[model samples]
Target: MNKEYINIALADDDEDDRFFFTEAFEDLKIKNRVSTFKDGIELMEFLEKASLLPDLLFLDLNMPKKSGIECLKEIKASSKFKEMIIAIYSTSSSEEDVENTFVLGANIYIKKPNDFEKLKKVLSEVVTTNWQYETSGLNKENFLLRL
Candidate 1:
């Protein structure tokens, strides 16, 4: 699983958001494979039996069918996905949402940016970051609460 290219997945219902996400990755010119799921159920189904899981998974909180919180809880409870980095990518930046996801074992929380350039920057930073090392250095005071 130590491949050169990073495996990235995004689950968001908005078509424009998904387009921007893919476009950002392409514009960055990074060596990575990106996958998009419209809802939580689709994402869960893909990951449940997939041989190789994405190194990073970006989840949008508000969606039809199942919410990100539900997906996050399910993913965190499973030992098989302990290595996967879960980043909460949502429009809402509520403190409650932030605290809940953090407590639920999300690796990071990124508030969706309105500006396209900012989105690109955020995506780039998240993709380049060595999350394993970051998590090892994670403290209650300096948790991955926001970006």
Candidate 2:
């Protein structure tokens, strides 16, 4: 919400992925406060109680207890999170998964990169993006973050 720094959140079940995500942001010059949740249930609970919502939410599709798809549906259904940007950060790049999330109102889809350098590059591009302008021109073709 603040112009000085970005408030970023990630809901991912994998410990290594969460660690890498935070580390990537730390390496980047961008000023950001990163929050990580182990499951969608935890993430939704925090969102419900927190006064300040995250500017961007990176959601992993395979989380247990509450899948990212279910969380996306819930978030999209509520007016409270209308302004928040949802990015699907999943390892699965299946066409079905991509199509399903795109149609379900996700702002962008990012296939998880295998290497740390690639992850940093992807995160850097995502963080620096002017989401307000980008969303206005959002289309299925540009939904997925390529390389």
Candidate 3:
């Protein structure tokens, strides 16, 4: 709710990906607090007990214990996370993945970028956008973050 800082959460299995995500946020001008989770289970545990839920959640599709698709389904099923903006942050940009996540109620679908600067740009755009308005006009066309 506070404009001063944004609460961002990422659930990814890869250690390097998690580090890059946190680093990208650190490089951005936006004030944010990022929490990284090694897997979906850890992410779910934190969300369950957390009083202050994250404003934005980036989920990776593949994980050992639980997958991002599973996490997305669970989060959407619960009314407690209705206000959260879910972003499918994964390396796969397959039509099936995009279609599935869009149908499952995720706000945005972002394919992991190969370059660091591009990642920062993608993150900045996602963070600075007016999600309130963006969600209202959410569609398959705009669902996948192209840049």
TM-score (all chains, Cα) for each model: 0.94, 0.97, 0.98
lDDT of 1: 0.90
RMSD versus native structure for model 3: 0.8
The candidate scoring highest on TM-score is: 3
lDDT of 2 at 133: 92
Comparing 2 and 3 on TM-score, the stronger one: 3
At residue 80, candidate 1 shows an lDDT of: 91
How many pairs of residues collide in model 2?
0
Q: Which residue pairs clash in candidate 1?
A: none
Q: Give the clash count for each candidate.
A: 0, 0, 0
lDDT of each: 0.90, 0.94, 0.94
TM-score of 3: 0.98
Q: How do the candidates rank by lDDT, highest first?
A: 2, 3, 1
**List of clashing residue pairs for candidate 3:** none
After superposing candidate 1 on the true structure, give the runs of residues whose Cα lies further than 4 Å from its correct spot.
140-147
| Model 2 regions lying over 4 Å from their true place | none
Cα error, residue 146 of model 3, in Å, equals: 0.5
Of 1 and 2, the candidate ahead on TM-score is 2
